[model samples]
Target: MTPASEPATATSLPIGSDADLAWVRHQVRQFAAEIGFGLVQQTKLVTAASELARNTLLHGGGGQAKIIPLISGPARGLRLSFIDTGPGISDVELAMSDGYSTEGGLGLGLSGAQRLVDELTIDTEPGRGTVVTVVAWATGVPAPRPGSR
Candidate 1:
């Protein structure tokens, strides 16, 4: 993984409406596929992206997502950052807890997105807005499962 200080190739997509959700998912899938992510990996990343994008639209009152392709060291990965300037989260820890939702949802979005990625970070301040970032690294060539070889 590349250090946070280092720059990587990135692009931004606006997430202002419902239709943008599909666009976000499509962009993530295409980027993951281009970087040789396996089917399962691509699906997981796309799913995570979908959840975040929806949150950006519905909860945050719309935002933008930054997608960065990471190719450094021994790993290849994609990083996504969702930013919103709506009413920020009042309690991030609770928000991240399973089954805790402010919108009457099942409350799986944040936590589930965390599980699908190698790294997750959330930054928010009440009345200031929020930023949620996630990174999923490709497995590269398949390796034998643990204890299988």
Candidate 2:
């Protein structure tokens, strides 16, 4: 059993190339499983990681991903933070809207990722970089909204 209301193990991985994206997804799945997330939970977390990792690589000029296991009382979950140092998003509001893509694709990266996770946060600075954090809690764990963590 994991420690209650205590910090668990965390992982950090570089997010540079396409290959790195695969590794991120794999590690995220593993982390989710380590915390006893069900198949659905693992799948969703992996999917969300994949999208954000891609954005970090393609849009942010590569970055790093930090995977952390969480335990708050009986609540357990996984938190993934994707950091990049490329050109930051100038308009986060427009960027987060559905069907908005800067690369001329389907434009569902950010919004789609938000739907797949329990909590999502975006911290970006124009010309500096971007950091996106997401958490997927195991069933029955009440996920905190942005700024509450």
lDDT of 1 by residue, 34-54 (tens): 988999999999999999999
Model 2 Cα lDDT, one tens digit per residue, 1-149: 22223356768999888899999999999888887888998998999999999999999999999998887655688888999989999999999999999899899999999999977899999999999988778875654443444
**lDDT accuracy of residue 129 in candidate 1:** 92
**Candidate 1 ranges beyond 4 A from true positions:** 1-5, 141-149
The alpha-carbon root-mean-square deviation between model 2 and the true structure, to one decimal in Å, is 4.2
- Per-model TM-score on C-alpha atoms: 0.89, 0.89
Q: Of the candidates shown, which would achieve the greatest TM-score relative to the real structure? A: 1
CA lDDT of 25 in candidate 1? 96
What does the lDDT read for residue 144 in candidate 2? 43
Question: What lDDT would each prediction earn against the true structure?
Answer: 0.86, 0.86
Cα RMSD to native, each candidate?
Answer: 5.0, 4.2
The per-residue C-alpha lDDT of model 1 at residue 99 equals 100
